[model samples]
Target: MGQFKVIVVGAGPVGLVLAIALQKSGIDFVVVEQRKQVPPPTAFGIFLWPHILRIFHQLGLYEDMQSIGQVMTKLENRSSTGEHLEISNSFELLEFAHGYPTMLFDRRTFAEVLMKNLKRSDQLVKTNKKVTNITTRKDGVTVDFADGTSERGSIVVGADGVWSTVRDFMRERAPPGLFSEGPNPFIAPYQGLFFRVPRPESLKPGQTVYVHQPNKQLMALVTATEAHMTTYERVPDVSERTYFSPNKVTDEDVKYWFDVPVNEQITFKDLWDDKVMGGKVNHDEGVIPWWHWDRLVLVGDSVHKVECSMSPFRGAGARCGIEGVISLVNKLNRTLNSNPDPSRQDLSRAFTAYQVEREPAARLWVHVSRLDIDLYTSKAGPASKAATFADGRTIPIVANSPVLDILPFPDEKEGVVPWRRHPKADGQSKDVKARL
Candidate 1:
């Protein structure tokens, strides 16, 4: 059997999680990041559902995650004027059904836990190693970094977020008309600003609050020590919505959002004054039709960039990305276990299976996420009435969670919402064989 080393790009939560999954699978892998450090101490709060927690349980990181993560129980919806709209304990009910609570915590803390659990993290993860280009050969693939170093691996996984250099490299090698939106495809209809502050006395831990107003929306997830907050506002001009690079929040934007009322107790200004760390962001949304070609594949925001927890989807974007990792790793484990020295055809079969399972799922969530943004930002919707949660639409999606195929399924309690085992993981599925 030939040496099989997977090259993983980016070191965010999804990337780190991918590394750990690869490690647990007994697969050789390396992770490279453009940043100076592994967990760069950025990003706001994120929510993880039971589907992902199942995988974490198998990986032995669930206990650590529970230690740091706040088990979110209830969601409170309110108007800009502090009027109570509707309160839903759907999350608590989901916990009862799935045996795992929906967890909310700082993104950096999540990254830290993922990195800490990797036994060979020091040797496997490389920092400040930006990918400049890629070359695919008949035998394997080679990744070129900005630092003028290079690494050869059996396959490359792009966990890089939106504006992924690996995705750009794939575009360069793809045939004409492969990418629908040309080079930069993501649409930035809404602008986002987020930060973390000490949990307000009025707000208790484990409470997720949403304040809805016309063309503006605010979401705050209160953890033990802090409340991670995020706000989204529609960009007045459609042309300015397409972002190619990082765009900082202007002083005017900050001032405008600061004055916006969040219930009657406090305004954004109060949160801004107490912020520990915060920044502006362009909320880009898109799902590419194809996610892999030859020896290169993509994951996370690199392929499908969806709305965050600020939307009704509750960070379905990240959750979906994590599932993509599991799906991809599961296929790779099967292929390598069957034939360690897999031909390009064998590898392509695995990649095709991975994309086939994930692409449609990503497209669906992206569409739903867009609808969520429209509901709140449109004058006829949230401006007039309180936004409602679509439990029927979201619950089914969560119930059908996938786990690792090579490992034994952890014994877990199933709630009212049944957890459907992934068909592909079972030997019954012919999707991969048909593709081959």
Candidate 2:
């Protein structure tokens, strides 16, 4: 591996995937993650669009993911008053890009597959290495950890989630005007709670139910497994303090909102214990202001925080992983391919290209996500519903945009395998059809 090295902070999917790609490119790298162990009882599910699925397929983990996740074929939107408004089969749009199917999977299960794939490479990927500081000089970069360990690398990637220390360090060193403007202002005020419950038999597998109520609120249910149901409801921002605070949530906080009498027997844990869900109650409250600076760059939640409304269609953090890997790979291949010596100029060019290609898409995703939230939170009335539907035109249909083409760098027909193959998933293809 010589002296050339790349340091990837955060052992989350994006960081690990980037390390895998770097290793395959014959680049030496190490991953640093804060968590000592993977958390149990998955927190939420991700809807992997066709483009993202293509990336997973290329990584050769599509079969493994299929074994654990459901492929969502249809998306239904219903008014809170119980009127079906729009129904679209996402698969049809995906067919134009490739035959690759869209999927919804438990986040933990997906991360587990990525982690298993990463573990095969002992020389790469390091966990529990919490990065405390990152310094870049003329020669190389140095990453200091909380445990008093330090490693030198030719480049450092900040895949750490929002509030990234790496991003802060880069900003301090970056020349003025080098980074993009701060995130856009919030267009609306909304909040929500995530609940998990036993799946009712009436809910078909792979079906997503969206309800818009007369109160200008939204509730969504996603069916993952025969026994699991994930539910979320939009509430006024004013009520956020009651639900988001660590203090115990009382029945009074949710009682007036429900049509039926509040279930005194049910506690917050009872709703979220068996199922995976996240909302304002679980996420950090802040906006991700920037993505890249000089030798350091960020990916996933570290650079862009997504709203819940867009989650069902947006693979949020996963999309960031795919984009980061592609952008980083392209930059590496272009800059360091001929000469292994990583100069300041080489690092600068790579980071610049990455930001140029990725920032627009990131901003657009944020905008569309906000729009979805606003539409779902608008006052409920026939006129309001009509106006809401009319407003949908403003939401950019990213599925049809050319930005998606920017993904899947190098444009290869087959997906890349980041790790050695494991035991083939038996009957996985059969299950894919069954679930869809």
TM-score of each: 0.91, 0.75
| Model 1 regions lying over 4 Å from their true place | 236-251, 381-389, 422-436
Candidate 2: regions farther than 4 A off? 39-41, 81-86, 91-93, 119-123, 175-189, 214-253, 260-290, 381-436
| Residue 315, model 1: Cα distance from true site in angstroms | 0.3
lDDT of 2 by residue, 114-200 (tens): 777764555566656777778777787789888898888878788776556677676667776554333221222444455445655
Model 1: number of clashes? 1
lDDT on C-alpha atoms for all candidate structures: 0.77, 0.55
Put down candidate 1 lDDT per residue, 1-436, tens digits, no spaces.
Answer: 2678899999988998899878877778899999999787764777788778877887788889988999887778777767787787877777887778888868877888998999879989999898888889888988988899998999999999877788888888889777654655677778778778998887788887887777778888888899888888887533233432223445576776666666568887888788877777777777887888888999998898885335534577788899999989889877976777788899989999998888877877777666766776666536323224544466677777677765555466677767887433454224323322
RMSD of 2: 8.7
The clash count for each model shown is 1, 7
TM-score: model 2 vs. ground truth: 0.75
| Model 1 worst lDDT window (10 residues) | 427-436
